[model samples]
Target: MNSDFLKYQAQTTPHPLAMEISYANGSYIYDSNNKAYLDFVAGISATPLGHNHPKVISAIKKQLDKYMHVMVYGEYIQKPAVELTKLLAKNLPSSLEKTYLVNSGTEAIEGALKLAKRATGRSEVISANKAYHGNTMGSMSIMGFEERKQAFRPLLPNVKFISFNNESDLKHITKKTACVILETIQGGAGFIVPSNNYLQKVQKRCNEVGALFILDEIQPGIGRTGKLFGFENYNCIPDILVTGKGLGGGMPIGAFTASSKLMDLLQDNPKLGHITTFGGHPVIAASALATLKEVTESNLMQEALEKEQLFRKLLVHPLITEIRGKGLMLAIITPSSDTANSLILKCQEAGLILFWLLFEPKAVRITPPLTISNDEIIKGCEIIIDLLDEIQQQ
Candidate 1:
């Protein structure tokens, strides 16, 4: 299987963690060899309820029995999609009452960017430095990191960048700018959280310039950051809120929400501005709706904070310089990139899953499932700490 994967599959990174999985249950992922690997990263923060969650699976199964893909998104009034969007609207602010569902986070971002341009009638888009929105062309254009995006040059035009958490950079957003897109808590950049009311200040600047403020909550939203959305924690309500990871209960889904007035713009002037055939597939919507319900209604959101505290308490070590970000969205910063790489690979062999951020080579990602137990948290942290000790002794 590994050989076939290497031969047939198009490679993204040269070195892939080729752990052939048999199945997963809760916070445990079983390899083809039947070895249980503790899930510490939760499929890169995509599986909020962990693997094979009963409610999510049941919802998917139920939806499958009823129906699957009916028609393109926004054409058919699918119950699952309607209910999911309604629930989202009820939870979000009154201004954000409409949602455009899509296949992945990148697609959601693309749609948001288009909507922003259409609504504001401007072309300039500003993104934060070291931000990772998605991999699509428009998303790639706004990506602050140049090294990875250099090869895919000639992306969208008139896109600019600002230093995240730096209030002084807010001045760059002018009336000519369509939108300022930022992650509520910047992911892939060492899980950098917004500080000193940075998000609020950005929104203020966007408002002053009549530019839309779009918040990419793909990594930090969906109850991962204590609040249902990370922007809520910072008191920054964006014009467009994009979400994806963990919203689908292990399925693929993404959505961008905006006010009815702004979202309506996508429909007119170009009858079908943005269309997706499988955006709101019934099975996916059912799974996502169930995930959202569980995250909001159950104690999982609150438990995330408790588990975060446990992680911080147990991850104490000389090698671990600092734990960045909040709630389940966290990054353990090591003293060196080599130390971070060694810990991630060694922890995998030690039966604990760990990952790295995109640009921050010295930061180890620790965004486990929100449903991960305290015992699981302690065990994973112990493995990490023991490995650090071994590395230090060497």
Candidate 2:
């Protein structure tokens, strides 16, 4: 199977953590050898309720029995899609009432960019440095890191970048700007959290310049940040809210929400401005709806904060420099990039799953499932600390 995977399948990276999985449940995944590996990455924050969650699976099964994709999004009134959007609106701020569902977070970013351009009649777009929005052409154009995006040049035009959390860079967002998109908490940049009301200040600047403020909550939203949306924690609301990852409960989905008046712009004038065949697929929508219900109704959001405390309290070592981020969205910053890489690989070998952030080579990702037990937290942290101790001795 490993040989076949290397030969037949295209891979994003040369060295993939090719774990032949037998099955996964709760906070643990069983490999082909029946080795129980404690899950701390949660499929890179895609499975908030954990793998094969009963409610998400039941929702998917029930929807499959009823129907799947009926028609393109917005054309058919599918119950799952409708209920999911309605519930999302109920939870979100009033300005962000209407949602346009799509496939993957990049697509949502694309749609939000289009809407901002359509509404503001501007072409300039601004993003933060060291930000990772997505891989699509438009999203990549705004990606702050030039090294990763240099290969895919000739991207969208008039896109600019500013230093994140740098108040002086707000001068770049002029009246010609269409939108300024930022992650509620910069994920790939070592789980960096906004400080000194930076997000609120950005919102104020965008408002003053008539450019839309867009927040990409793909990694930090969906009850992972002790709030339904990370923006809630910062005391600022964006004109456009983009979410994915955990929102689908391990299923593939993405959504962009804005005011009804703003989203309505995609309806007429141009007519069918943005269309997707499987954006609101019934089966996926059912899973997302169930996930939303569980996250909102259950005490998982509050537990995320408590779990974060547990992780911080337990994961104490000399090699560990600091832990960045809040709630379940966290990154353990080691002294060096080599140390971070060693820690992740060693912990995985020791029956614990740990991963790395994209741009921040010195930061080890620890985004576990929200449903992880305290015992699981202690066990995982022990493995990490033990591995760190071993590395320190070397």
Candidate 3:
């Protein structure tokens, strides 16, 4: 099966983890050999309630019995899509009343960028130095990192990069800028939080310059950070709120939301700014609705803090320099990238699943499911610490 996967499937990496998954439940995944691995990454923080959650599975089953993909996006009055959008509006700030559902985070980013340009009638876009919106052209254009993107040159034009959490760079967001986009928590960049009222200062600058503020909450959305969205923690609201990754539970979904007046721009000007075939698939919407219900209704979000403390207490080691992040989205910083990789490999061998950060090589990502048990947290962290200790002796 491993050989077949390597031969058949298109891989992003040459050496992929070829564990043949048989089944998954809660915070654990079982391989074909019935080996249970405690998951800490949660499919890159997409599974809000963990794998094959009862609510999510049940919602999917119920939706399967009903209709699926009956109409194109925004063309039909799909009940699940409409209801989900309405529910999101009810929870979000009143200005973010309109929602444009898309296939993935990158698509929503493209839509939002186009909408920003159309609404403000400007072309220049600004994003953070380590931002990871998505892999698409527009998102890649605003990504700030040139090493990975230099090969895919000539992306979108008039895009500039500014240092993340640096208030001094707020001046770059000027009247000529169409929009300023940023990850509320800077996911790929070590989950770095804004410091010293950085986001507030950026928001003020954008307002003064008439540039729209787009907060990409793809990784931190869906109550991963003890809030519905990471931007809420900072007190400033974004003109455009982009979400994906965790929004669909285990399914694929993305959306960019804004005021009705701002969102209406996508309808005119070019007469259909952005369009996608499977943006609002009914089954995905059903799963997302179920996930949102669980995250918002239950005490799962608040319990995240307790779970985080448990992880911190157990993940102690001289190799672990610091634990950077809030709620379940944490990164354990090791002495070096080699040490981080060794610890992850050793931990996986010890029946614990761990993963890496995209840019922060020395930081191992530890964003588990928000519904992970205290026992599970302790179990995973113990494995990590034990492995760190073993590797330190080497």
Candidate 4:
């Protein structure tokens, strides 16, 4: 099976972990050998409520009994899709009353980019340095890292990048810019949290130039940040809001939301300007609705902050430089890439699941599930600290 996977499966990386999974529950994943590994990575922060969450599974089951993928998006008014959109509208800021759901985060980004250009009647898109939106062409086009995107030349033109927290760089968002896109918390760029006054200044600059501000809350949305969205902490609202990652619990989904007046632009310019076949999938929508309800109504959202405090308190060592990010979206920065890599591999080998950020090799990701218990948090942090100590001794 491993050989078949290696031979047949398209290789994204030269080497893969090749860990065979049996199943997962809560914060743990069982391997084919029945070894339980503490999953701190949480499927790259996709599984918000954790593996096989009861609420999510029950929702999927209930939806399956009723129906699944009944029709293409925007054609038939599926109850789950309608209810999910309505729920989003009720929770979102009044301006962001409409949503365009999609199959994944990248698709939502593509849709949002199109909507931004069409809504503002501009072509130029600006992103931050070291930012990562997704892998699709439109999202990849706005990616600020050149090394990763060097091969895919001649991408969408007029996409520029500015220093994320540098106030002076705000000037680049001039009149011709269609939208200024930013991750509310820069995920792949070492999970760097935006400094105070940075987002506000950017928003103000966008207002000055009539450019739309699109916040990518893909990684930090759905109560991961102790807020419904990361922007809530920054004291500002974006013209466009993109969400995915944790929204579906363990299901796949993404969406971009905006004001009804603004979102309506996508309808007229091309009639069916941006459309999808499975964007508003019923089963996925049901799962997302259930996930959102749990995050909002239950104690999970408030516990994120408390769990974050626990993680920070326990992860300390001489090899550690600093910890970046808010709530559970943490990145433990080491002194060098070697130490970080060694610590991560050792942690994994010792029955823990840790991961690396895409560009920042010196930081280890610790984004566990929002449902992880206090004891689980302590256990994971202790494992990290233990690995750090062993690495230092070497």
Query: When superposed on Cα atoms, how far off is each prediction in RMSD?
Result: 0.7, 0.7, 0.9, 0.9
Query: Candidate 4 lDDT, tens digit per residue, 191-274?
Result: 999997789889999999999999999999999989889899997899999999888788889999999898888878589989
Alpha carbon lDDT of each predicted model: 0.93, 0.94, 0.89, 0.91
For residues 1-394, what per-residue lDDT tens digits would candidate 1 score against the true structure? 9999999999888999999999999999999999999998998899999999999999999999998887878887899999999999999999999999999999999999999999988999999899999999989998999998999898999999999989888889998999999998889888988999999999988899899999999988899989899999997899999999789889999999999999999899988888999998899999999999999999988888888888888989999899999999999999999999999999999999999999999999999999988888888888998999999998
What is candidate 3's CA lDDT for residue 324? 90
Provide TM-scores for the models: 0.99, 0.99, 0.98, 0.99
State how far residue 36 of model 4 sits from its true place (Å). Answer: 0.3
Error of 2 at 330 (Å): 0.5
**lDDT per residue, candidate 3, 145-244, as tens digits?**
7887999988887889899988888878899999999999987888898878788888899999999999999998999888999888887999999999
Pull out the clashing pairs in model 3.
none
Residue 62 in model 2: shift from native, Å? 0.5
Task: Identify the superior model by lDDT, candidate 1 or candidate 4.
Answer: 1
**Number of the top-ranking candidate, with lDDT as the measure:** 2
Off by over 4 Å in 4: none
Given candidate 3, what's the lDDT at residue 245?
A: 85
lDDT per residue (tens digit) for residues 1-394 in model 2: 9999899999999999999999999999999999999999999999999988999999999999999877888987899999999999999989999999999999999999999999999999999999999999999998999999999898999989998899999999999999999999999999999999999999999999999999999999899999999999998999999999999999999999999999999997789878899998899999999999999999999999999999889988999899999999999999999999999899889999999899999999999999999999998898898889899999
